[model samples]
Target: MTRMFRDPVFGLDADVVRRSVENVAPPGAATDIVDLFARAAWSGIAEPGDSTAGFLVSAVGASAALAMLVERWSADRIVRESMVDVDTAAFATQLDRALVRWLPRLDSRSTVRQLTLAATCRAVLVTPEHPSWPERLDDLGPHAPLALWLRGRTDALRDTAHSVALVGARAATGYGEHVAMEAGSGLADRGFVIVSGAAYGIDGMAHRAALASQSTTVAFLAGGVDRPYPSGHSNLIGRIIDTGAVVSEVPCGGAPSKWRFLQRNRLIAAVGDATIVLEAGWRSGSLNTAGHAAALGRPLGAVPGPITSAASAGCHRLIREYGAVCVTTVDEMAELAGMSPGETNEDAAARSSEETRVLDALSVRSPRSPGDIATRSGLPVGTVQSVLGLLELGDLVAEKPEGWVFVPQRP
Candidate 1:
């Protein structure tokens, strides 16, 4: 039987899409580009960490899964008819709900758009079959992304097998930023690729320090690689694409939301060999990433900050409550993450554990309270006014609306 080989969208030969995939295909990726295309479609259809998406793709195939969604098959029919070989009872339980969540977003154009957008953005979709695919992510089991939508150096992802994730608050303070910079630069110097979500504050500082140290860094975005999140970091993200990679589970044109951000944190935790909360507030989202790392059995690190700082409270909580290793210096972070001796960063700066640099951030000229200060500084503010009075004595700044302004220094 002569099977017709064609892409339903372009009505051209299926090989047309296959050739397009080759633009970003690494040396060891799946040779069949059509299957790669299917995975890309499904990536957009399902949200990140959708186990049902993983199960469907695993039981059948990306192409067949796409076909199931395309044809609008019912959950009962899919389990009874298509997934006949599998254990139906358990899979069917959640199958209906999964379809409900997935079907509303199901637009054929959505999948087609991912391919066209990938070509325009010079992006690649890497599946488990790909040689450069980070094998460690498979440890996520059914929660693994259906496939990765990537831009930048595909080779950089392989480093994820031995990478460290440094994540913390976006409203970082001078102290927190300094530690993040030191930690990021120091870890990158140690030959470990840095992994993070490219948000402002801690995540941004980590990415910057990694690049400054001339080490590769990969960022996982909550949205499509085509549309980077926090839009403020466009230039920073652009720089990353030139050297490392920006990856996402969602397809092109997808906007980021609150749920996606939380889900994206899991990828950050999963992609790294270890995860460290450089500085986090009590309710900071970085703590969420820390939770995933702990759950995944990845070594977790919490950098200690001032005892009074609410910014580092999350880190303190982790150290005290979650059993996260206390990682003060870069060496400790490396040791905590189990960095191989051979992976040492030769030109790493000669800095001791006790040495801490203050990475000052000039906040917007508005009255911010001590809590806000700690959030920005990665320090905790004392609930007592005496602490502010002490700094006032030091001539740091006269208080205005309970906020502070730097006092001019004596020459």
Candidate 2:
């Protein structure tokens, strides 16, 4: 006997619901097809981090709560039916506001399309009921995601007990990129799954280093997992999908917005065991991720940079004012994530302070002479020459007929 989910407000074919979820849903988990469909609908109906929707779904099952909405049940009636032990007046006010936000997105066809698109993209839909769902997200309380749309290994979410989120400004500097690479590869070698937004700069470098180390990584997107945002990282996101996971609270085919990106930070903070800000400017969006980590009581670390560099101002701010631990090496980061100290290559015969300063002074494009490098780096001309020789030996810098220019390293 085929079961059809029909209501006055919307109708769903049970076969379509089952087909959409069969491959993604774990065996012997969430056999109720209607409930799964309702959860998928809620993912599109509510924006990321909608507390009212979270409260409703938690108070009642997703199906019943969605039923009340579709049926146009009054706020008072819903409170009575759900038997929630809250003050009627206060709860009703919240429900009324939530209704205003939710009702417009209650179309059944849109949800069906989302499910179809997800199926076509081979994306997995993970609800709270799924065994592989990350329980750490429950700490988010009412702001937690109602469901997750994933591409790639779904087990990555379950295995996040040792995940570390490496986040920073999209406009990362050479110094920041270098640090991100070290942190990403080092942490991965120590068995920590790297987590990031998959944006350009620090985030992309971190993911690449983790991939280079042949370790698992996870990227949380602000938009649909089907449509990778920033378009530029589409190829990078595809690579992440090969071994890692790309996640989103939004369903398939949705576009990224500023508000969605801000809300997405909370998931990165919650999903990772700890959060590290590699490099950020004064108003960098990565600070938003740090704030969420603080609120959730997750360990937060910041990498300090040269005081003269404005790119690291957010990290400095976090260490000085927000009580974020100052982390300079991969071991320090691992310790911040509650791992004991381990042997690391961070202290190896790497770039010296002079080398770093000279490298920073030289641009990839406009070349600079030794005198100009010394002036810009505030090092002696003789010292700059010595450091440049060492850097040239490492193939980090090359002297053109014009002057010395930085040779960017590929991850």
Candidate 3:
């Protein structure tokens, strides 16, 4: 049955009681409050609570008499014993002056064909009330968003419950971007949904790799999903929405804000089963996401990089100080996602002898220069260089100030 209550802020009879109950209840939690009412009018900007009619006159002026009365009656009790009345029209007019303010401007147009397309693709929005909504996110406590707007197959959210957020700096080094790609592709191939911000650098690489590998990926936006903030990654955002989802709690037209970005990190951390810092600097926002992941008691991992590089500072910090595990391969990420590594069989042995020879020539100690490696490995310099480039791209071998170092990460 639709009922009405004296809205403390708006004055006209509004469904404030139901809305308040929905806001306070944990995601998916329901209450049987037959008579939920506003015994106390929420006052103050930062923290609004309850109030009595007598208190309203003094605290909110005589105009708020009805609101204050409703609040006082609505207190601790589930429903009020009796309804108090006053002039709501006058109170609403007064509140309008205090509450009316302009929202920030939004971008003229965003390249979010993905979001619109998702809706067209029959993707559904899963608010807190949805049975499929993740309860673990409640670990965020009050910081959790009121709702999680999903725009892909809802099954992905439920089935990929073991997702891990892979995030890092936008100004990523080649090493960071490569690792992100491998991890993203590897994890996705294993059926894990890759979650990221859809920003450039590590985020873009991760999403692209997953799509390239035909895997699902979700992007959590700081602003409206329609407005891919960076603008440089419109293509990636579009692809993600094509196969996965782009979600945000801010209204559809809300502009991005620094505070909103910080807040958005918490969602990425809470929604996933774990988090991996692919690449980040000393003060990168990825570190903030890691903090949220750790605070929620989720397993955190970091891909270590060259000690000399500033881009890996955040990852190193997590591993050394914040207790994040060090991971090097997608198999490890799959394990973290609660899945077994994929099997490699005899078909892998169908490789040409030249390819195997080239793989063997790359090493850490006594690392051969490309020219020398070509001669030692008894192959064309072009072939050796090509193979070495692949190795370098994989982060298996890195060139240091001293020389090339062969780093064999976990299988």
Candidate 4:
């Protein structure tokens, strides 16, 4: 006989709930199915960075909290039942306001639909219980995500010890893009996972350069992972999915709004060990990300640009007023992340010209035969084969059944 979960709180079919979440639940985590469903529902009901909702869930567990909501428990009753240490009268008033905000979106059917949509999109629901959940996000306290909707490799989130958030202006200048490309690829080579919003200009260039360097890069989306925002970067997001990850606190099918975009910046700041603003105007949104990093006490760096350029103003402000480290090179950026750049510099110095040429000849997506690589790199096939062997051992290039391709190292 098959056991069924028929909790009236969910207002969802037991089989449907089981089927939708069973595979998507993080493997090896001792997660209760009903609790997972409750958390998923809460994710859609509460807007991003809802501290009151976080308080409620933390007070009595997600399942119990949802059950209380379903049972129409009064704010007074909720505060009393939660037994949290606080001014009961004031807490009840706050809870009442939160209830008013949460009650309108408490449709279980909609939540189930979102869950089904997540399953359809092949996305995973990563709760705090998951081993891969980025622990650094806990620093957000009540503002942290209850669960993350993730697409692509889950390992990307698990390996955040050496992550850097590269954020800046969407209207990036040529100088900004050049610096962004250098920092992105250089940091990647030094074994740091690049994190960024998938917006155009500096963010897009940062992601592309990381991919080109054959390294893991994660994008934090303001909208649902299913509906890639900025629609222009759909192809780029797809490439990230192939190797890294696309993550969001919003449930599947949620739309990105200005408020959500601002809140999203906090996650970018929280997840990374350090954050760098490559270029921005005085009022650029990247400054918002920088602000979050500063508040979290994460190492913050800003690349200095020409004083005359408007695109550089935010970086200048961060350095001059906000106490951000002035980072002009990848080595400086690495130091900002508390990594000594000496070994990386020595390794870079030791690499022969042939190795660089062979690497430059390989494509991240398309595989090429040694003879073709030799022709493209202007090296003899024998030398190309020798260099390929060395690069393969270094995990920079991989041999596919078809031929040779650039392989991004997973952090």
Best by TM-score: 4
Candidate 1, RMSD to the unseen true structure: 14.6
* Whole-model Cα lDDT of every candidate shown, in order: 0.77, 0.86, 0.60, 0.86
Q: Can you rank all candidates by lDDT, best first?
A: 4, 2, 1, 3
Cα RMSD (angstroms) for every candidate in the order listed:
14.6, 14.7, 17.1, 13.6
Specify the highest-lDDT model's number. 4
Clashing pairs in 3: 39-71, 39-72, 39-74, 39-75, 40-50, 40-51, 40-71, 53-68, 53-69, 364-406
| lDDT tens readout by residue for model 2, 165-224 | 999999999999999999999999988889999999999999999999999999999999
Q: Rank the candidates by TM-score, best first.
A: 4, 2, 1, 3
**Model 1 lDDT tens row, 168-248:** 999999999999999999888778899999999999999999999988999999998999788999999999999999998
The residue ranges of model 1 lying beyond 4 angstroms of the native Cα positions read 1-30, 82-87, 340-411
lDDT of 4 at 176: 95
Candidate 2 RMSD to the real structure: 14.7
- Deviation from native of the Cα of residue 102 in model 4, angstroms: 0.7
Worst 10 residues of 1 by lDDT: 353-362
Clashing pairs in 2: none
